[model samples]
Target: MRTRRTRAATAGIGAAALAAAASGAVLPATSAAEPARQQPPPGCETDCEKVFDLSLPYDVRFTGWRDDSAPGGRSVLAYYIGDELHDSRELPDRGVQDAECGWDGDAQRCAVTYYTGAHSTGALSALLTADRGIEETDSVRGGAPGATLRQLDGNGRPDVALRQSTYDPNYADAPRYWETYLEFEGKFVRTGCGAPEQQPSPAPTEPLYGSCAYY
Candidate 1:
């Protein structure tokens, strides 16, 4: 079970709406004419480097999306506090159709996502912390912003998805281990696949107070 909520006003926006955007459903603000941005693919490669600073600490809070339709709905935000290579929370899932991973040296954390959304209204935020200390760092890929990775499940269906970025400590001519930025874009995964391989029958974890973490 998750713990209590923590409220932070780093960004002024509703959480529910952010989650919706994370799901890839377009909002009123963006126009269809706007050229769609290319997304990243699953796994790590040297070619990803988009970064944005939410200017907030790592914590969970219930900003919006708290209605019965999406119970346990809240905006998740976190600062990567683990080592390189892998995020402890970024577990593999059979249901995950696609996945993308990134590491931020500035934040000193790793971020892995199953999907993405626009403007962070209803986006699900997962922290990239390791059970062990931090992981080792490796070569980086020059990345672009707003790139997404789409995943297809076992039944040839879309399951997990996410946005990602590669770390470049020297991005702004900063020193190694001193430079940090977020790269990549958001993702939209199928509804059924939670964190674990199997999920509850009724689908949509929120209604059942579900989370990505499954026993």
Candidate 2:
């Protein structure tokens, strides 16, 4: 819910009239109770906006399937760079999923594998298959939760996967976000951000210097 792959490299909505809401800001009554899983802290808007403005004008798609038909659930996220396989990573805290990455030609592709596993110690490992051949590494951990592994190009651009980690290593839920953006096909798209949502709560009228407006 935080960020669903940068769509169209850009992405807003209205206030009031809760029933007719479609923007990320609006949510059903039942969902309203579900506070955002996380968000950025005060004074992070500048950094957060850097990623948001970079990701503007991109397109995003989402898909999820149940590993089983029972009660709890798990999900997978596949991020595409202009229709090519940009990266595919799974949610860990949700249900202990695994992900792996590799390269093909000048492009990189990722495969997010899912299976039942133990909680272990805030981390888990998985096998990766790609042009680079097979390798295994810790795909998830405790402090950072679903942090992924990433690589960059000669220009210091995100050519491979983009890993998201806590802004502060000491706090798993700190107010900071980071991501990598790359040019796929023709246009450049940002792949991630720290806190991208604008909570539906009322905005401050006095405009205090320390007020928080980020997700």
Candidate 3:
């Protein structure tokens, strides 16, 4: 319902991550015969941004940095368990459309968004649970943008709200508005009453992964 612009560093970063991931590229390890590689004199890049808070038991925070040589810089999220770097990865959404992160019940809930043409692309949402039970759920809500997520269950299960223009696309005016909230377990299930009617909207033709009901 409300919007906040994603930080500039995120611009096109998501797409870059996608490209890198798709390419299946890897850097080679240094050879034993060669002398130890010299490390560059680092600045306050990641530290100044506070990638992680060591005092906290857990945190999922977003950080950004500029790289002119890069298509548009970098947008990354770091996941921490205590002070250890549980995991970190590049967010290739191209821009920081919006993001939310915090512990829900006993699990960690994190999400972020970015722009894709005229429509908004809800990139990803992740649930980091105990015993290293991490679930990454993405939208089959493709080809469109504008998505919101909420944790309905006190135990941290998620409910997502996705909206897209269903009206004529030829005009500049925003498309006719239609929205639905899908709950996630193994896949999304209708959280509302009964088998609801699917509105006349331009739903994604591509198959939805997980238990998704985008009709």
TM-score per candidate: 0.17, 0.21, 0.46
Across residues 1-215, which tens digit of lDDT does each residue of candidate 1 receive? 12221223234233443554455543211111211332222221222222222222222110111111222221222122111112211212211111223222212222222222221111222322223222323212112122132223322111222212222333332211111122222223323222322111222312111242211
lDDT tens digits by residue: candidate 3, 9-44: 224433543454356532111112211331111222
* Deviating ranges (above 4 Å) for candidate 3: 1-74, 101-106, 129-135, 142-145, 151-157, 167-171, 190-215
Give the least accurate 10-residue stretch of model 3, judged by summed lDDT.
26-35
Query: Candidate 2: which stretches are off by over 4 Å?
Result: 1-100, 103-135, 139-151, 154-215
Error of 3 at 203 (Å): 18
Which regions of candidate 1 fall more than 4 Å away from where they truly are? 1-42, 53-83, 88-121, 132-215
At residue 185, candidate 2 shows an lDDT of: 33
**Candidate 2: TM-score?**
0.21
Candidate 2's clash total is 15
lDDT of 2 by residue, 1-215 (tens): 22332223211211121223222232111111212332322222222211110110122221222233333434334333334333344343344333333222222223332333332212233222222222223332222222332334433112322223344433344443333333343222344443422222221211122222333
lDDT of 2 at 123: 23
